[model samples]
Structures are given as C-alpha cells and as structure tokens.
Target: MRLSMPWFVRLAVIVVFATGLQAAPAPALAGSDQPPGMIAAVVARVRDSVMRIVVVHPPEAPPGEKTMAKAGEGHPVTRIGSGFVIDPDGLVATNRHVVENATAIFVATPDGGRFRAEIVGMPHKADIALLRIHTGYKLPAIKWGNSDALRPGDTVIAIGSPFGFDNTVTAGIVSSVNRDIMETPFDDYIQTDAAINHGNSGGPLFNINGEVVGMNSVLYAPGTYSGSVGLGFAIPSNDLRFVLSRLEEYGQVRAGMLPFRTQSVTAMMAEAIGSPAPGGALIAALGPRGDEMNGLIQPGDVIRTFNGEVVTDPRDLARKAARAPIGSTVRLGICRSGTIMAVNVPILAYDPHPQPIQEPGPPPKMLGLQFSAAEGSDGTIRGVAVSAIDPTGSAADSGLQTGDIILRVQQQPISTPEQARAALQARAAAKQPYAAVLVERNEKRTWIPVALPGE
Candidate 1:
C-alpha cells in the first residue's frame, strides 16, 4: 500500500505558507526548550513543493530486436528520484540523470496526486533536465534565489523523497561554497551538511527565506545505498536557472568547448617551469582534428582566464567556459612558452548522438585515458580497445597504464563500453556509491577505483 504524508507535515505546511513567518512560539516541553521557530517555519513552507519522482524505463526485447516481447517482457523498470515545480504552467526541473532514458515519469506531489510527465529538454553534460506535466491546474511555484550571494555556514534545507519517503525534510548549514567537485565538467557546487540520499536527486534546497537556492544532487559516500553522512552537494540555482532559461528558449543547451584537456599545476611544477602558475590550469593536450587546432589553445600553456573570469583552477576554467553561449567568441588569457597571450575561441554545441559504426573502431580518449580492444577470441568482450595511456587521467593516477584491458567493473565482467555502463547502472541501483574497475594491463591485473558521475 502507498503511504501518504503525515498530518503534521500538512499542518506545518499550512501554518508556514499561510502566515509566511514563524508561529508565535511553541510551548516548552516540560522543562525543555524547543528548537528555533524560524527554522521550523522555513521547512514547513518549502516541504510541500518538494516531490517524489518515480521514473520508469521501457523494457528490453531480444538482441537485435526493436520491440518488446508481448508476454515475456517484465514490468517497466522504475527508479525513484525527486523534483520540484518551477513554474505555474506545470513545468518541473530535475537532474538530467534522473529522467535520462525514462519511458514514463510520474511526479507525485505532497497533496497525493501523481501526474505523468514529458521531458522537454535535457543537457547530459550539464546534468540538467526539464519536464512538463499536464496537471490542468494551478501549481505553486518557487522563488529562485541568487546563488551568487550564498556564503559558507548559511543555513539551508533539503526537501525530497528519501528512501521513497515523500516530502522528507532535512536541515543543515552550508558546509562550503564554490567547491569544484569533479562530478560534472561545469560543476560549481554548493557543499552542504544536508542529508541528500538516493531519492533526493532532483529535489530543491531552500534558503531560510523560502526561496530555492540550489538543487540537491549528490553526496560523498562509501557506497550508493548509504544514508546521509553530513557531506552532500547541490547545483547552485544561479547556474541551473541559466540552463533552465536556455532550455526553455532553445530546447537544448549550447555550451562552448575547447578540444583540449587541462589540469592545475602545483607550485613545485610551476617553479620548475619558471611560470607564475598561482594554481591556474595547465594545458595538457588538445583534441585531434577538432576546433582546438583552429589556433585556440596549445600544450604547455597556462590558462589565466576564460572570457575575463580568472581561472584559479582547471575546474574553474572548464565551468566558466562551459556556461558560455555556443557560436560566441570567448576571449582566453594564457601564458604560453613564457609569453602571455590572448586568443578568441568559438563555442560549439556538442551532439547528443555520436556517429554509429557497424564494425568496432579505434580507441577513444576519455578523462585523458586511452583505451583499445583486447586481443584474442574473447567473445564475451567487444569494444574499442585501450592502446595508449594518459598519465594525468584518473585511471593513470589510479595506476592504470598502457596495455591494460578493462575486463570487469564493480566485479561485473564487461566486453564493451555499453556493458561497462550497464554494470555501473546496476551498481547505482543498488546504491553503490563508488565502483572499482578490474583491468588487465601489461598481461597483469589490478583495480582502478573511480567515483561515479554526479555522485
């Protein structure tokens, strides 16, 4: 049986939303004092807007088949996340990861009504997804806050479905701000002590004034199914609001990208190179036959700024550049070969669908690691092999080198990138926070532990 929210939650919602302020004061519990009145009021006003999202993926058919088996196909697979109403027209905002590949999405409000949703737009790299529900009724819209004004130690509230518990509220202080957690290339997250769990993914994080400040998205945990540990992160409303506006206007996000990979240079490396790094990004390499060759950026260069924003770290550069509009010429400040130079870069929109190939192709470079197919008649494994190495990639940092074949991930054997993705999904469903990939490098074996994206 489906359980409804407790009566107390509804009453609290009425008291706070109706008065728009804290109640006079609660009677002291025999010789004990109650918590702050303002904190309690904020939670009540925001809780009702938080929702539970139950996403269903279409079932699979036999290999090489396009349709589902009429009788043999199992029930539609479902995953639970969270979301909130963004506009009065029934428009809702959620994490792209939540609705990606969902065949059916159900948004359940605190009032106990569930409505079907249609995905309007989603930018995978930005990790933002927008959905619309045909509710045919007026909805409560949240006031967006200025994320730029946020500071460390600010009190915040997270509202969402935790373990399928709809409208669960958790309060905490902003542990930090402007943290460059590498979960997303454009990640400039607001770190909070709020408890964000598996089902908390698309929920709203509110400031004390009842405005939506950020979106609860990720947490640092040992495994997926683990509960809150006081270290959770949210995508700031400032960036998300920008993406939301673009999505509403263009039906997609147009972000600029340089065909290059970079990292922050340490003080020691900067001293050795005689460059005043001051912790800016160092250009490592460029994409092959891509826009980068158009004289945008080069290797052994220190990037100082992107479009006038100081690039204090590699993540900062990536984040600022990613938010730029596509087709716009962005100015970049760099120190190349001991000479400070400036270059104009054109931003381009990346394609959601990669070109399809019938037969297996050469290796692909991701996060700086180079991979190719394994040799032998191993029918179980089939993918572009890893033949090279990126000494700066997470794989390389985890001790992966040349001649390594990625055989299994999280203990599940994989023959292709698709299979590896499936293994990762399985681990995610089980609430496994991190994954370890077992690789065969140089005819030997070892494990490369990588944190899953957006976790």
Candidate 2:
C-alpha cells in the first residue's frame, strides 16, 4: 500500500533531515568534508561545573529599629543566581550583588546535590565575589581563558539558570570588548549577544575551547521590558583573576590611589597643549593630600604612560594605578610644554576618610603671597584666603589671583598662612620643583601648579 504525505509536512521533514545531516555528518574514512561537533563537545565539558546559588536573607527590622532580626527567625527572603566553580578545592566566583546581605547561601550541583557555601571575599569597587563550598571532595573546575586575546565575533557560550531554569545554554559571538557600561569605575566588560537574564547573574561565559573567559553580570533591556535584547555584558576574566588574587592574599582588594583627578584629553585641549594626539589623561586637579609635592605630575600636564604601559585615556590610567602595589613607586611618562618627561611617584593606599586640617601659627615671609583666614556668611572659617600676589613671583605666573582662596596645599587644607608656608618649605626642602595648590575662585575650585622659587 502507498501512502501520501501533505506538502507542508513533507517540506518540514526534508528541512529537518537536511539540518541533521549538516549538524552531524556521517563518519568518513579519509579526506571527507565534515564539520566537527564543537559546540556540543564544549557544552558537555563545562556544563557540570555551573551552579545555582540560592541566598536566604535576613528579615527586615521594624521601622526606626536599630538592629535587624536574626537570620532563620523571621520570614525568609530568597534570591537565586548562577555561579561556577573556579578551583577544585571548591572555590566559586559570583557577583557581589548576588550574595549581598545574605545570611545563608546554598549551592546546587547538576546531580541534585546541595552544599552550604561560605563567603570568602567581596570587593566593593568591583562586582565580583568569591565563595567557598565544602563539598568534602574535589569538584570539577573551569579553566580560565585570556579575555584580552578575544576578538569581536569569537564564538562564546553562556551556561546559567535563567529564571530558575537550570542548565540553560545559549551561544553567540562576542559583540565587542573593553566596553564601559558606566556601572562601575572598573568597567571593562566583554560585550556579547548571549542570552542572559535575571537568574543568570554570575554565570560563566565560555570560549569555544571550553575555557571560562568572562562572568555574565548584566544585560541591556529596552524600555519597560526586563529581558535581554541581545546586549549582554560580562566581567572579563582577567579583572576577575586580579580580584581573586587580592582576595586570597588580603581578604579584600586594596587599590592604590594616584591622588589626582584626570580628564580625557580632547582634540582642542591636545592642540592647546601641543600634543600630536589626543589619547592621554590630562591632570585636571590634584587631590588635597596626594603625592604631587615632587612636581612630577602637575596641572596642565598630560599623562601618556604609567610604569611603561601606554595609557589610552583617563580610565586606562585609573585601571593601571589601581593595580599597582600600594606604597610602591612607579614612573609616569608625562608631556609638558610638548616635551616628554618621566617622573617617579610613590603609590599610596586609598584613604576613604581623610583628617581635617588644623590651624597653624604665624606666617613666614619667604613666599610672595599673603594669606588670611576667610569667613563664610555665617562667620565660619572657610580657608586660607589669598590677600595679595606678587606680580613677578611664580604664584602670579601660575595664575594665582588676589581674590582666589587658598583652600589646600598638596591636598592638605590651609587655614592659616603659616600652614601654606610650611607646606611650601617642605617641598623646597625636599628639592621638589612645584607645589600643587587648590584655589577657590568665583565659587569654583581649581588646582594650579605653582613653581617653587629657588632659595
């Protein structure tokens, strides 16, 4: 007996057969044109290492209460996210926002086994966090790939639990690299078209070689919609490796501060400064208490390199500075008056809270500027107000006007002329070339590089 099939059904069958044949070609003896099963093999290799993290948060306290209720006592709030094992000893990495304020964390494996996790360390500046789970045995871990070597259009796979669905796999190409989403100061995200969603936070972004290259962290959604629009961002594995190293050594990440504010060099500013290209970071303002006393880096100077690494812009300088060892000295390549010069500056540990400056005694007459305590409208001391300027002195040449208020010298507040003189004398005693002065003019604050006069 003969049977007839519908035209649409026959077409669908033919398409399916052709796709299957393309996906999995028959085994050939020699010199056959057949595609390798790369994606399938990659998924099989790394899917078992991905984990679903469930966090139980402590209950909120009553209004106006000083303390929160203890964990496991109040109503439980649960949060779910994804993570991956990075070490065989059960070291897992995830987003800090995932386990933030979590009283208890649980990790679920692919084989229906659950284990308790302990928070190892979480860096404040970066969104990465490390956790340790005691599985009582060695767990499968993923190998790290070089995110810096990734080019646009490289094949990548994302494995995570999207919306509580476990082990969801998606594949796409790298859309871009070194993307700054403006979410954090250290934003060097690897942009991909991988399908990442709410529960996919902290999942592993894998390369074609089954190596972890990035950590899926965020996605861009259109207005009023909370789904991925093919714009997914992952924290590059290179930055994550740095954070992990710091966490292992110090239990927290410690970044070195350059003690200065910088702005991206524009084409107009570059021309004004006689720079051939607009790629360096321009020194906009010196920190109130930075290492600018050596006169190495100054206002109007452009930074082109840090420790022999080329600085493309302000963010590059910041990233390089933050990675440097605290209290260690590094050389900075700077451009001044169209001349390239190198200056060695010591990196200082970042201080979130700085001490307030106190008033000093009588003023010295060495410098050619007169300073007095200025008062606000309510009669409060504002700063050391500049009363006079010597026209032929370095202060006047550096654009110090009479009405400008001397707020700080070398980043320390100056309440009296004596303090300003002392700072200047210290710089001179150290044989420093210039002193960074913070001046308030017309309700705006600016940093001026004043050349110290020879004794």
Q: RMSD, each candidate, Å?
A: 19.8, 27.7
Which ten-residue region of model 2 has the weakest summed lDDT?
8-17
State the lDDT of candidate 2 residue by residue for 1-455, as single tens digits.
Answer: 00021110000000011122212232131112224677778999999999988765444567987544332233434567899999989899988777766555668788866666777777666777888878778889999999999998788889887767788888778889988766654567899887677788889999988999999987776555666667888989888888887877766778777878888898999999977789888988888865544767788889998989888888778878888988899999999879999999988776454322111111212445667778888999877877765432334334576667888889797888789888877987887657889999999999987656545
Q: Model 2: clashing residue pairs?
A: 288-411, 289-411
Candidate lDDT values, in order: 0.66, 0.73
Models 1 onward score TM values of 0.65, 0.67
Off by over 4 Å in 1: 1-35, 58-73, 223-225, 289-293, 352-455
lDDT of 2 at 210: 90
Q: After superposition, how far is residue 91 of candidate 2 from its true place, in Å?
A: 0.6
- Please report how far candidate 2 places residue 434 from its true position, in Å: 68
**Candidate 1 RMSD to the real structure:** 19.8
How many residue pairs clash in all the candidates, one count each?
13, 2
